[model samples]
Every structure is written in C-alpha cells, then in structure tokens.
Target: MQKRVKYFLIRLHYLTVNSNHERLHQDREIIYGKRGLRQYWEITTDKETISDDSTWLVMTKIPKINYKKVGKIYQIRAWVEYGFKQSKSELCWADFRVTNYAQIEKWWQLVMSAYLMVSLHSDSFNPMVTPVSEKFQQHDWWNERKGWKNILNNLRLIIKPYLSFNIISRWLKVFPIPQLSLGLPRLINLMNEFDCLRYFVYFWDNFYYSSA
Candidate 1:
C-alpha cells in the first residue's frame, strides 16, 4: 500500500523527451533505462550541446521537485563521498583492530575527532596552528605548506608539548610525581637548554622548524 521515492540514473541512448511536447530547459519527460526501467525525469542539458556527456540524466519519483533541486542534490552527493573518503583514507577509519563494541566505539570516536578537527576549520585559518595573517603567510615554510596535509602536521606539533607528559616521564624515569619529573625539568631547562625564552615561546617555528 506504500512505496519509496528514489532517483535512477540512466544513459541517454534509451531515453529522450517526448517529441510532441515543445522542448524546454527542464521538462517532465519519459525515461527508459538500458534494462527498460521506466520513470519520469526533470530533463536538463548543456546550454550549447544537448548530447554527449553534457546531459545530466537524473530520474526521480518525487512529486513537486524541480530540476534545480535535482542538480543541487547530486552536487551535494560529491561532498558526502569526499567526507567518507577522508574518513577512510586520511583518518584511518578502518585501521583499528578492537574486538569489543565499546573499544571500537572509542577508536572510531578518536578517528572522527581528528577528522572533525581538520574538517571544521576553515581554509582562512591556514597552517592551522597559527591564525592566518598576511605577515605570517609570507614565510618560506608557509609557501611549501599551503595544503591541508601540512596543516594537519602543523597542528600535531602545536599540541605535542601538552600531550608529551608520558613520553617525557619515560625519558626522566621518576621523581614519584610525573609533573616533578617531567614538567619541572622542562620548565627549569626552558632558558638553559634552548638558549632563550623566544625559542621556547615560538618553539614550533624557531626550534622545531630549525631542527627539521
């Protein structure tokens, strides 16, 4: 007693608008798939040539939807696919080997958290770690790192110090408290170990960049 509304993409060879009807930019026309599946379409074509790959042959069963809506919906599909791609390839969405549901959930949460961090930021905030300014963008490293991959790497360096307590503790071994062993040492050596506070303040740019 009920049905689902959907769109089916069919090649142009098996479908064309009714010849008796005067052609318009967008017309509700009959469509026939290669396998003979029939549906109505909001037909649109290129401004110059209607044939070849210029035709966007999207068919749908939705009532009251226009050609513009169809075009926009398909355009949005591309971005959705791109997000999934970044989630998989870039964020290692499937890289975790957790056996239990809770472990898998946390792993995916961490993965998506990273993906969300990068995705939510705008290109205006380029290099990511630092706010984008005309003077800042003029650096030599900035020229080579005008891409998202470099932005992610820069973000890691910016946050590394705050996350390095465990690693720093391993290096120092023990003073009972992690802060006393790791944090106090770094704070004490801030000036002596690295020359000046200028290098400590802008450690990523001056110290890390120089070392790299």
Candidate 2:
C-alpha cells in the first residue's frame, strides 16, 4: 500500500511545492511507545517531492491545523537550517576548541557578533562590481558564495591595529608607539585594496573633529 502511494505521487504532474494540484492527507494514529500510547497527525503529501522518486511524510503531535500552515512552518524551518549552515561553514561558528565553559561562551558570542555584522553589510561585499578584473575579481567571495568568511577576514585585518592597541594599553597602561607606526601603513594599504578607504577616512575625520 505504501509502495503504491509512493508510485502514484511520483507519477503526478506538478509535484513541486508550488503546485496547486498537490494533495495532503492527514489522519490520527496511536503510535506505540515505551512511555504510553501517543496520538499524532500523520500528514502525508500526495505529490510533494521528498527525493528524486519519493514524497514526504511527516508526523506531528500538534493539534489539527491547516495543511498549508504546516507546509509554511516547514518552509520556515528549512530557512533556519540554512542559517545554521551559513554560520557553521562561513562564520567559523564551530571552529573553537576551548574546553572551559566561560571561554566557549565568550567565543560563541564573538562569532555570533561577527556573523551579524557581516550579514548587515552583505550588500557592500558584493563581487559583481563594475570594471571586473580577470585576476582579482574572479576570486571574489560573493562570486564564489563565500562572502561571509571574506568579509570577516577583511574586517579583522583592517581593525587589527586598533584592537591590538586597545588590548596592549589595557594591560600595560602605555601605548605601543612602535607597533602603531608599523601597523597603520599596512592597514591603510589593505583598506585601499578593499575600496573602503574613503569610508574609513570619512569616519576617522568625523570622529577626530567631533566634540565629545
């Protein structure tokens, strides 16, 4: 019976998610378990694609609701999974190796913060800039779907000098003037390469001239 249902679904025309001709079958069943008898809504898609040759079958203990609502909820879940994949793959969300609880928590917070910043500036990181170069633009992160990591790396390189200065001054009460001199030039060159010097200079000038 299950095999017949599967074959019928695969043979149906317009088996995609957007198909209006698709059908949903819902029934209540007492699923046996070690705890006790549990009732669930066994929602099966008559023409929804699960794989190349199969349809989807979902079981939920939630109260009876519209099938379209269930589908919408599933779609949202898919998007959430996509976000987790992005965080893990592009933001290095799982790259830490700390065993201490506090350190692990702090690392996760930093990673999440960096991910948020990169996502907020995703438009600026586009690889489809005009006057494309064969050598440089070809390897652009946006072009290769690796924009998040590239943005994080670029921001880190540009801000390393200031961050280093802050950390050193916090610990030693004195600024490392020698390191500043060596770092600022390289930082400026990097900003120029990333085409962010104008914005950087603008912000610097504003902060310098602003009355606190």
Candidate 3:
C-alpha cells in the first residue's frame, strides 16, 4: 500500500522519516534581496526513526544542494565546534579585551597560529594518519584512547623543560650551592640503590609512554 499525506489549509502533515540524511521533504521560498530575488530551501531530514529526535529541520540559502550535502555540512559544523572548544581550553585562546578591529584581527591570527601548532602535533599522534605512529601503535592502550587533548598535554610537557630553564636562568637571583645538595651522579646512585629509576618516569611518560 502506498503511503498517504494529508495537507490542510494552515499546516503540513507530519512526515515518516526512515533513514539518516533521507530527504523527508524540501521546498523553496521567496527571499527578497538587493539582487531583486533569491531562493532558499526549507529541508527536513530523517534521523533513522520517527519516534526519537529523528527528524531535523534545515534551512539553507543554497537551493541546489541535496539532503546529503546538508547532513555533511552539519557534521562539519560539529567538527569545527570541537576544534574551537579545543582552541579555547587547550591553546589558551581567549576573549579579546581590545575593542579595535585591528587588534582583534591580530589576536585572531595569534590564536590561529597556536591552534595550527597544536593541530600539527595532534595529527602526528593520530593513529589514523597515513603513516601510523609505528613506535606506539602496537600498544593496545594507545589506539583505544579517547581524545586528542593528550597531544596538547604532551606539547605542554615538551615546553616545560624550556620554561624551567628560562625561569631558573633569568629569575633565580640566589643559587643553591653545589656543596649543599647531592649532585646528579649522587642522586642517580641513590636512585640505583633504591632501584626506582625505571618506576620514576619523565613527563613524557604521561604524554605518551615512559620511554617514547
């Protein structure tokens, strides 16, 4: 039996959506503009079910694009949103206090630079990269990880040594006398005595593994 839709004077009847990205319905409406005329699509997509939040309404000015394109656009939007959130939280991107448009633009450029830096490291660490990270790929824990935030974390770790060096060199006016503290060799001897070097790991151990 063929499905039926009942249209009334004031409203359109509900559509039975059956699959994701399936175009439940689409129509164009007049959008008057400076160019004299424009058209837009009022689109609905199926989310694979009728009872759930299974239908989505999408409005786009591009009337030529199909429902699948609309779905991909939204998916891309989700990825963009995720990247923006990462910029804010991980890359120290912040709201601009300067009201000048030029300053705002400069801040945007700096933020984008930081974002690109993190993205480079993140891409390198991604298991799905064209050339996999062969060193850690075999570890079960490495592949089953949750998010790329760890890449930013490892980056922070990498910068920490330089930061410590900078602070100690420039800011420390009083230095610890070599006689007062155990030297690195003595410390290593103590470590060997306690047998703790293998267990006590570097910051990258948290970034990836104890060694690599």
Candidate 4:
C-alpha cells in the first residue's frame, strides 16, 4: 500500500518542500475513520534520485496545512538526538547509581551544565588550529581541532591537580573559620571519612548557616 502511494506521488511530481536547502517532494493525505479515532496526516516524501531507494514517511497529529513545519521539526530533532547521545556516551551521564528522584534530577542538571560548558569552550577556539600549548602536541588525544569530548577530557586532567587538598586549603582561608585549630585539610579529611548521613548533615549545616 505504501509503495503504491509513493509511486503515485512520484508520477504526479508534487510541489517541492524546502527544508534547509534540501528540496523534498511531499504529498500529504488525511485518514478519517470512527469518531473515537483521532484524525492524522500521513506524509510521504518522493525518492530524490534513482540511487535513493526509500521514501521518507511521517505520521503526525498536526494538520496537513502545517506540513512544511514537520520537515523542519525532523531536522531539529536530529540535532537534539545528537546532543543527548554526546551527553550520555562522552560525558558519562548514565554512570550515576542514585535512587532518589531529586538526586537524579540534580545529577542531570549538573551533567547538562557541564556539557554546555564544554561545548561553549570548544567553540571559542579556532577550528583550524590546536588550542593547546606545544606540550599537549605529544599526547595521542591532542588534535588540530579538538571536539567537545576531547576538550572536556583534557580540561578534567588539567584541572585535577589544582583541586588538591593544598590548593583548596589555601582558598578556604578566605572564609571566616569558627575554629582556627580545625584546619581545612583536617576538616575536609574528616568529611571524606564520613558516612553518607554524616556528610549530608555536614552539607546541610554549611548550607543553612551560609545562607544566614
């Protein structure tokens, strides 16, 4: 049935649907049945060339009058899928083991923010040239034009050393300490050794008092 419809449309030579420079010939038909069944538009694109063997089909609740927008929506959907794929695979978005809904939501927010940060940072560099120093040239992952995943991985390696106990301790001195004897390293080490509940309590205490 589908092949017959496609052949009929091809014979008719339907008007071209312009979607981002790709000229697609589209034909839409409305299918109607019982009152309980909702109406839908069955849209099919004619094959572009003899080499292209398949016809693209889209079924939508949207009216036939808005068929041009459907092509654009599909183009945008591809980009959205690409972003999700990169986030999950490259950014390790599926690595979390949390059972709480709130915790999972927060993790997704952080992962998206991190992904956006890497994307923005990569865009700042010239695509034709390497953004790193000569020292990074010897590394296997280093390239003339680094993708978002490579940029993010390299950024993690570059920032890891600066997040050490010594660096964090120095930075924490700016905050007014309640106990001078309780150094940042000792306090941080204690927090590291704490169980999940203790850590949660400590975090909430700091958060509540900090806001006050």
Residue-wise C-alpha lDDT for candidate 3, range 11-102, written one tens digit per residue: 12233334554333332232333222233323333323423343334456664764445555653454678777865666555554778988
Clashing pairs in 4: none
Q: How accurate is candidate 4 locally (lDDT)?
A: 0.50
In TM-score terms, candidate 3 sits at 0.44
Worst 10-residue lDDT window, candidate 3: 5-14
**TM-score, model 4 to reference:** 0.42
Give the C-alpha miss distance for residue 1 in model 4, angstroms.
Answer: 39
Model 2 accuracy (lDDT, Cα): 0.48
Q: Can you rank all candidates by TM-score, best first?
A: 3, 1, 4, 2
RMSD of each predicted structure: 13.5, 12.7, 13.9, 13.9
Residues 1-212 of candidate 4: C-alpha lDDT, one tens digit per residue: 24222222232223333444544445444444332233333344543442333344545555443545655565454478886696667767777789999998888777777765565445443222224556544656555555666667766654443356455555557775545325544645544432212333434434321100
Per-residue lDDT over 1-212 for candidate 2, one digit per residue giving the tens place of the 0 to 100 score: 22211111122221234555443433223234431222332333433433433334445545654344445555444578886687656667667689998998888777766665555445554222223234434433324334666655655654665666556654444544666566766655644565423244434434322111
Residue 195 shift from truth in candidate 3, angstroms:
32
How far is 107's C-alpha from truth in model 2 (Å)? 3.0
- Candidate 2 wrong stretches, greater than 4 Å: 1-66, 79-83, 98-104, 124-150, 160-212
Ranking by lDDT: 4, 1, 2, 3
In model 4, where do residues sit more than 4 Å from their true spots?
Answer: 1-65, 76-83, 124-143, 163-212
Error of 3 at 116 (Å): 1.2
**Which wins on TM-score, candidate 3 or candidate 4?**
3
Clash list (residue pairs), candidate 3: none
lDDT of all the models against the reference? 0.50, 0.48, 0.45, 0.50
Please, what are the lDDT tens digits per residue for candidate 1 over residues 5-28? 454542222222344643334334
TM-scores vs. true structure, each candidate: 0.42, 0.39, 0.44, 0.42
